[model samples]
Target: MPTVNDVEWDLVGISEIRWMLGGLSRQRTNVIANTKGFPDPIAELEMGKVWLRRDVEAWIRDNRPELLENKKGPTPE
Candidate 1:
């Protein structure tokens, strides 16, 4: 939850995204990932893709505002 010296940003993969969206299933996460204009992942590793937490959260705020209503602050742990 710490962004050291503003260089180490938080990242979120499918698991974190799912957890953020209330335990969404993998398929659901895929659907969201495939959505047009969904933020492009900052990195794609062997496990899957990873997105900057801020990018993902902003996308959610703009595209799915409801998701952010109950969430705590800009980033949720």
Candidate 2:
């Protein structure tokens, strides 16, 4: 299996996605997840849903670029 750093490892679960989005509330996360063009999950595991970081990043960039401006983290290259 590939390591996180080896691969883009953009695939992430709901909680991780929430954290990436600055720790959004569960309700808000649900709302955002259901929004159109929010990117379909790569897999639906028992733990929760997963999404491609690239897809989510694209959505955020196209819909809410402002969020990126305030974010503080090592953004994917």
lDDT (0 to 1) per candidate: 0.82, 0.79
Query: How does model 2 fare in lDDT?
Result: 0.79
Q: What does candidate 2's lDDT look like per residue over 1-77, in tens digits?
A: 44566657568777877876778987788788988878887678888888778878888888877788887566789
Each prediction's TM-score against the native?
A: 0.76, 0.73
Which residue pairs clash within candidate 2?
none
Q: Candidate 1 residues 7-75, lDDT tens each?
A: 556889998998777788989998998799998987799999988888888888788787777675576
Worst 10 residues of 2 by lDDT: 1-10
Measured by TM-score, the strongest candidate is 1
RMSD, every candidate, angstroms? 6.8, 6.6
Worst 10 residues of 1 by lDDT: 1-10
